[model samples]
Structure formats: C-alpha cells, structure tokens
Target: MISAISGSVAQSFRPPAISLAARGTESVQPKGSDSGKSSRLGALTEEQKKQVEQLKKTDREVRAHEQAHKNAGGQFTGSASFGYTVGPDGRRYAVSGEVPIDVAPVEGDPAATVSKMTIVASAALAPAKPSGQDRKVAALATSIRTEAQAELAAKSRDKLSGKDESDSKSSALSAQAAYTTGSSPEKGSQIAGSLLDLFS
Candidate 1:
C-alpha cells in the first residue's frame, strides 16, 4: 500500500467540502433516498467499513504506543493511514490501518503472547475508561493476540504429540512383558527376541 503522511493524504485529496449538515450527522450515505447508499461518497463498503473501523483504532493505539517514546524523551514519528469518510455525527474521521506491526507487541513465546493479549484485553474491558477509540485499539490488539494464541496452540499440540508417542511406546513394552507369562527358558528366549524385534 502506498504509505503517505496522514496530513498529506487529507490535503492532497480534498473531498468536496460536504455540507455542514453532513459533517454534523457524519452520514456518508445519502439521506431520504431510501437507497442506503451514495454515488459520490468515497464511503467504504461493508468490508471497507470494517477495515476502516479497524484502522481508526490506530488513533487510540497511537496514544498508547507513543507513550513509550515520550517516557524515553524521544520524538515519536509514529505513523498511521487514512480511510476517508464522514462520520454519522458530521465529523471527518480519518481511518488508518489498525495494529501496525510496530504498534502491537510482537508475539513470540506462548506466555509472552498471552501477556500481550491480557494487557490489550484489560484496556478494552475496563469499565471506568470511556473512550471508544481505546476500545477499538484494544479490539485490534485482542485480534492479534488471538491469532498468536492459535499459532502457539498448534505448535504446542505438535510438540505434545512427540511426548505422548513416547509414552505409547513404553506402554507397548509393558504389554509385551505382561503377555510373556510362560517362563520356560525357550519361551523366555522367544519373548526376548520378540521384544528386540519390536524395538528394532
């Protein structure tokens, strides 16, 4: 995707100054037409709306992610994208990609993945903090975390099977010993030979 500064994006493509009315209502869809759509709107499709909502979430993430830079007393050139749309409340909300690679913590170990998930989940689930943007940001994080958990789980299952298979081999050996009850020397020799064959 062509990456450009958010400000440059806004200035470069000026959607006709929508009426103050649309700006107030933020409805990209046409009103009173009963069509539930717009011809001129660069308005998002259902999927695009979902994408934009996901992107808009980066705004909240920007707030959270940039804090690290601020604490370190560094200049934050944190970036975001634009999904051009007028909101229902008649405001211009710039949409961008949510959960930029740099914004969300990387998923490595399973426990670490869970930790990242918990932190983002806590921010989303908190009752006292009343920011829609925060909720979206957390939602994006939760999405990534869920994916990480699934990856970790699949890896664990594959690893788990190796150990389980070893246990099965041991059980087979025990079964062989138990069945070799006839203790005559010839029988013992045959049993030992059979056990060796099984191992081989």
Candidate 2:
C-alpha cells in the first residue's frame, strides 16, 4: 500500500525554469567587461520588466520562508500541499483522488485540529461557479469545517477552555489557534493559503 522514490529522482522533479527576463535579474555591467552574458528581453517595456521582477521577488520570498520552516523543523501535515499542479499547457489541476483534506487526520494534537479546519475554511472560500481545484478545495474545506464546527460545538466548555489542562491539551489549543483568524499562519495562505491564489 505504500511506494517510495529515491531523493535524487525526487529532486529532479522540478518546475520549469524561469527565463532571466522572467526572473527580473540584472545584467553584468562592469567597466570594459561586456562578456556577452546578457538577458534576452525581446521588446518588453520597463513596466513589464518591473512586474516580472516583482513576481520573481515574491516567488523567492515565499520559498525562503518555506525553507526556514523546514529548517525550524516544520513538516507537512494531513492538510498541507498543492491541491493542484500546473501542467505543460499552463493549466492548473489536481487529480480526483488526491485531495489533501482526505488524508487521514493526525490524532492527539490541537494543531492537527486547526490544520483540518483551516483547510475547510479555504475550501469553502474557493470559487463557487468553477468546477475545478478551486471548487474542489473550497467544497472540501467547507465540508470539513462544517463537520468540525459541529463537533467542537458539542464539546463541553471545560474541555475547550484553557484554565488548566495537560501539556498535550494546551499545546493542541495553541496549534488550534491558527484557525481563529489572529494566528500567524492563519492570517494568509502560508499554512492554508490557496494554491490557486499563490500563482494569482
């Protein structure tokens, strides 16, 4: 029921490279040292250049944060991942069977609870008219969130309250805070930010 691939093969599975122009990189311009290494910008305006540069900047910033997370021991949970991937045709998609929320819940932590509900909120917020990843994520998120809210509402105040609890319960409560709108990762899609929204 499980399959694995080697790290080298996995590393090779990268997205298409961005052109220098697309990445908004500068040319090497030293005094009397034009060694023919230059970006090929064919007719793109200054505004276009700036826009491409901004996109590159955002891409790098996001990746750096991601690396920092991993460096600090952040790992993917049942609710995290690209719900859909972009294809050669430049279209976005996720196969029908691979929805992130469908992954089995990681039990015993409040962070797991928040991860579940955060995904539910995102899925609920996806476009209603579109019949695609947006629709799927939104729909799934809504369903999960609905189920969770009902479940949470049924718990006694003593259970949900934090006056005094075990370490596991307290940590879980802290992790669950991400779904409450004020948490760092919950403010945007860093943790549950829409995949579709990222490219947009």
Candidate 3:
C-alpha cells in the first residue's frame, strides 16, 4: 500500500532558501561606488549616514559568512522540500516531508518524553497548517510589497514634503519589532536596527 513518493521522504528534509536576501558578496566596489545600496539609508542625515554605512559594512561581512555556508551546500531546515529515494523493493521514488526533530528527555519533567512523543504522533496524524511556508515567506515578500504600498500611502497622508515612505515604513517596522518581538528595550532597538537595513 506504499505510495510512489513515500520512498524519497529522506530527501525532503534537505534545507531550503529561507534567507531574505540572495547569496554571494559584491566583488569589491569601484573606488567610490555604493555597493549593496539602500534607499532608506540614502535618506539619512550625514551623521546617521556614517552610522548606516558602518552597519552596511558589517552586514556585508555577515553576508560573506552566509555565502561561505551556501557554498558548502547547506540548506535551511525550516523550508519544505521533496527528495528522491530508493525503496527496499528496488524502486526509485520521491517523497515529501519536514525536518524531523529528535525530542530528548527534559531533566525535571517526566511528561516531557510523553509530550515529545505526542507531538511527533500528532504531526503524523493531523492535517498540515493552512498558512504553511507561504506565510513565513510572506514575511519577507510582504516586507517589500507592504513597504512599497505604505510609501505611497505616506505621500498622501503627510501633505507636506519633509518625510518619505521609507522613513514611515522604518518607524512602523520598529513598532512591529517592539510589539511582536517583545525584547527588552535595548535588544528591541537592535533588532529594529537590523530589520530596517535588511528589509529596506
């Protein structure tokens, strides 16, 4: 009673591209060019621009590290994928599945073992969540799309010309980080800073 795809389930656990940005690093900017440009940073004051540029340099370093990881053939476990497989009956097959977690026992809780077993069993038995990876992806996609839409909306709302959409979007993004992330004020500020540069 085994299905054709059942054999390849192991391959389905391969990593995926969950990163908001693409792989690779800039091949050294022309003497004075802006590599990996950001419109939001472009709008900042001179002092702020210096800070943003420093951050950009730091981000470029991070991306280089990530690219090294990508080159080594690592993938994001969170992404869903299918893989090719071979069954005991000597047939090639394809199967789709998620990254399986090996739930170990917790020190103080006897129920932890039962809870892990129940989670694994339930994942096998229950229907998949509707939103799926699409929603997780939407976070990045919407960050751009929603930013564009909000930028237009800001033009209409402000009337006067001092502020731009990127500014408003950055502020709103900060508020979202504050509300959803629920980090301490300092950590929240740091997350907001990273999000602004990465998303904008």
Candidate 4:
C-alpha cells in the first residue's frame, strides 16, 4: 500500500550580520543622496568600503546557493526568490534567498515516490555549505524514502509467502510502523536489508 504524504519544502538562507559597524552604517545612509556624485566627490570611508565588499560577497554566495538547488532539483523546483538589503554604496544586494522544492509523494506508487525523494534530498544538499533548513529538508526526504522502501519490502514479502490481501496489508502496516518508530531494531534491520536485496 502506498503511504500518504503531502506538502512542499523550501530552503531559505540568511547570513548573519556582517558586522556591528556595517549595521550602524546601513541606518545612516541618506535616503535620496546621489550615489554617483557622492562617490565622485569624496572616496568612501574604509568602513563603508568594507561593508560594500561584504555585501558583494554575500550577494554572490546567495545566488550560488539558490542556483545549486535549482540545478539539482530540475523540474521539482521553482524559480528562486531573493531578499535584498541596500548596501552603503546605494546598490541592492541579496541578503537572503529561497528555493521551493516539491516534496509530495507520487500517488499510489511507492517506487516512484522513493525515486523522487532521493532526488529531493540530493537537491537539498547540493550546495557546498547547506543551511539549517536545507539539512532539515534532506532529513525529511530521507524519512519519506525509508517509509516507501518499507512498503515495497512488505509487498515483496507478501508475494513470496502467498499472504492474502488482509494479511498483506497488516504486514505492510506493521512494517511501516516499525520503520517509523524504530521500536524493533531486528525487525527494522530485516526490512531494510530486504529492501537492499530487492533493489540491488
């Protein structure tokens, strides 16, 4: 029997504050000052220059992080969105970003769901340095995949032993419960070993 699963997952990233000085400078910039003229009239203070460089670095990192998710997720992911903060240089820089990923299981097909979850987990960890949310999504996908594998193992066991429909479903439910709660280490291990054998 196919387990019911739903919902989507997105990984969002927001770096920590660059520095205390940078934060203070952000609040003091004139709202409507001409950036070009100001740069031409007087060179930026060393602190302002450091803040601009930090913002530039953050912008590059945010773009790369989202792009990694998009590239690995393929059709399962949507376009990335960014949250911007204006730098001391009066240019907008991406301070945070998110990439939405489809995490819903394929209806009535545990094998297909397993495959999809594997891809989803891979996408979540595709970046060089995954954020906390990215790790959570990966862990969720892994749990879903394990459940699907348990279901598949149950079906295979029933077919081999010639169990009737009611008995088959009971076995499947038991297997799913064992995997979910990890109540019986031996039983869980047997199911997991069976899954490996079946897939391998």
Give the top-scoring candidate (TM-score).
4
Residue-level lDDT for 28 in candidate 2: 33
TM-score against truth, every candidate: 0.36, 0.27, 0.23, 0.64
In model 2, where do residues sit more than 4 Å from their true spots?
1-103, 108-115, 123-131, 154-200
Worst 10-residue lDDT window, candidate 4: 18-27
Q: Give per-residue CA lDDT, model 1, range 1-200, as digits (tens).
A: 11112222321222234232211214354356634444322555677666556645743553443343223212212332334445442335443221222224453576676665566555343434324544554565577678788888899999999889999999888767667864355567899999999999
Candidate 4 residue-wise lDDT, 86-156, digit = tens: 76666667767777888788888999989999998999899889888888778888998999999999989
Estimate every model's Cα lDDT from 0 to 1: 0.47, 0.38, 0.38, 0.74
Query: TM-score rank, highest first?
Result: 4, 1, 2, 3
User: Least accurate stretch of 10 residues (summed lDDT) in model 2?
Assistant: 1-10
What's the best-to-worst order under lDDT?
Answer: 4, 1, 2, 3
Kindly list the per-residue Cα lDDT of model 2 for residues 36-149, writing each as its tens digit: 213333345677566556544544543343233223222321222222323222222321111122323335444465575464444323322223443444454456556555
Q: Which pairs in model 4 have colliding backbones? A: none
Give one digit per residue, the lDDT tens place, for model 3 in 33-140: 353234434555788666545545544443343233223212221222223232222222233223322223334443443443344333322322312432233233
